[model samples]
Target: MIDSHNHTSFSEDCKIPLNEMIESAISKGIKHYTITDHLDLDYQDKRFTFSLDHQARREAIFKAQAFYKPKINIYYGLECGVQPHIIKEAEAVIQKEQFDFVIASMHTTHKKDLYTQAFYHGLKPLEAYKAYINEFAWCCEVMNEFSVVGHLDIVKRYDLSLNEVNLEDVKDEICQLLKIIIEKGKGIEINTSGFNDIFQHAFPHPTILKWYKELGGSIITLGSDAHFPEKIAQHYEEALNQIESCGFENITVFKHMKPFEIPISDVRASLKLDIL
Candidate 1:
């Protein structure tokens, strides 16, 4: 199985070192994965700003790749948390460094951290959902430098009840966003982080995956969004099952910013035999 997203100490919120995180993935039989540390420039919560030591992170990734060569394929990647205000700043960083993959994400709205209660203070659940989804749609429409959009419906992450946020209410905007993603040849990730959370489902949900497929979109990647060793490749079996049911026979894996397909059947069989 290929885990397309993860973080280490390079990210402001995570504490694990890159080598330790890689060792953990290797232990889990994940031979192909990417280290996508966070980089949200000019974020609202000064403490949550996702900046990185570019050269240092690059050196660490290269060292890991050399040590694990032939045994594991470790790709260097970045999870860029974007807002309209910092588009150029994000672009400059992307241009300056070379990344194997770039996962575009929206971690805040109006510079306020979405994970905090302050983001939802005045708005009802549905209101917040609409606003968040619209902001995400805008980002998707405007951003073209990313390989895939991370957690398209991540607003659900903060919702108290999954039922409180209905996709039908925001279907038009979501569809528009999906269309733009497809037109731009970008994809979405099945962020498995939601499985253990109160949301209790993958980000973008299965229905949205079906919608993307129905819209003639096919590129989809899987990510554990792991910040620690234990979280590496979390809930991948369930995610694979859901993607298969959504009519996807293959999943995208990236190398040097280019994506290729691997059959889900192969991944499933490998998992059943404890070989992957």
Candidate 2:
């Protein structure tokens, strides 16, 4: 199996060492693994910083790549926390680093951290969703360097309504965002982080997969979004089953900043996974 998005010590929030993560992936027999540490510039949180050291991170990845060459394939990737004002900074990092994959994610909507009450302070649930989507669309419009949008409907994860609101409520807004993504030749990531959450669903919800596919947006990568070792590739079988149900025959893999497709059936079989 290929897990295209992950984190390590390089990301401020995740303290796991690089070797530990690589060892875990090898144990799981993951065919491909990408370490995408966070690069959320000017993140509002004073207690945590999401800056990355390009040289240090690349050196570690290369060292591991050589020693683990026989065991598994490792790709250097980055998860960028994008906002309207920080778009240029995000683009600068992309230009400077030759990362295999870059996940443009909006951790903050209008410079406010989505996980905090500050993001949802005044607005009602649906209004909060619209505000987040609008800000995301604005970022996508200005930034043109990333590979795929990470957890496109991440707003639902923190909805004060306990997700009492469904995607249909913001369907039109999401449709416009998807179109912009498609127009930019970008795709989305199926983040499994939410599967274990209270909502028991995938990030952006798996149903959006079919919507993306129907809209001619075929590029997609499956990521566990795991910040630790044991959690790598968590709930993948369930995520893949949902993808198959969404009419996707293959999931995306990236190398040298280019996307390649491997049949979903082949991946499932290799990993000895069945529908959950």
Candidate 3:
């Protein structure tokens, strides 16, 4: 199976060594995986400020490619926060690097915005949810270099109270953002990490996936978004089932900065065995 999003020690929040993570994934029969380390440039929370130094991280990624490829296909990538002020910097980094995949994410509402309780203080639950969606829409409109938009409904991870913000109520706005993402020819990731959290469902929600599919969205990637070795390939069976139910035939994988289409049926067959 292909795990399209992941992180390692290169990401400040995830301190696991790269070699160890890759070894665990290989043992799990995950033939393809991408290390999309965090690259949020202006997060306000110092505690969550675990991101790599751009240049050093890039060099390390490239250098490790030779070693990692022989064992399993390793693709270098970045999970960049798409805040308005940092768009230029994010774009420059993508253009300069030979990254196999770029995941545009909405981690912060703005350059100073952080996904903390303080940020949601005082606002009604629905209002706070709307604020996050509004920022996400704006990010999708402006960030064009990304190959896939990561974790469309990540704000729910922070505040489970916001999960009450039904997709139907915001369908028009969410669809507007999806339209821009489609126009830009970027895929949307079904981040499975949500299952590991309080929300207890994959990201973008089933209803949102149905909406995107109905809207003519074809490119979708599935990721465990694993931060630790144990989390690698976590809930992949469920993710694949979810994708198939959504009418998607294949999931996109990356190598040498290009996409490879893998049939969902083949992935299903592979999973039945103890070894990949």
lDDT of 1 at 236: 79
Which scores greater on lDDT, model 1 or model 2? 2
Question: Which residue pairs overlap in candidate 3's backbone?
Answer: 12-50
Between candidates 2 and 3, which one is better according to TM-score?
2
lDDT of each residue in 1-276, candidate 1, tens digit only: 678899999998999988899888888877688999999888877666578999999998999899998878999899999898888788888877868899999889866788874577778777777777678778877877789999888876775753576778777878888999999999999999989876657887898899999999999998999998999888878888889889999989888889999898877776666642
Ranking of predictions according to TM-score: 2, 1, 3
Worst 10 residues of 2 by lDDT: 267-276
Q: Which stretches of candidate 3 lie above 4 Å from their native place?
A: 110-114
TM-score for each predicted model, relative to the true structure:
0.95, 0.96, 0.93
User: Candidate 1, which ten residues in sequence have the lowest lDDT sum?
Assistant: 156-165
| Model 3 lDDT tens row, 132-240 | 7788878778777788888898877777788887777878878888888888777899898988876656897878888889988888887888989998878777777
Q: Please, what is the whole-model Cα lDDT of each candidate in the order they appear?
A: 0.85, 0.86, 0.80
Give the alpha carbon lDDT tens digit for every residue of 121-190 in model 2: 8888888888888888888888888889998877877764838777788878887888999999888998
Model 2: residues with Cα > 4 Å off, grouped in runs? 160-162, 273-276
Best by lDDT: 2
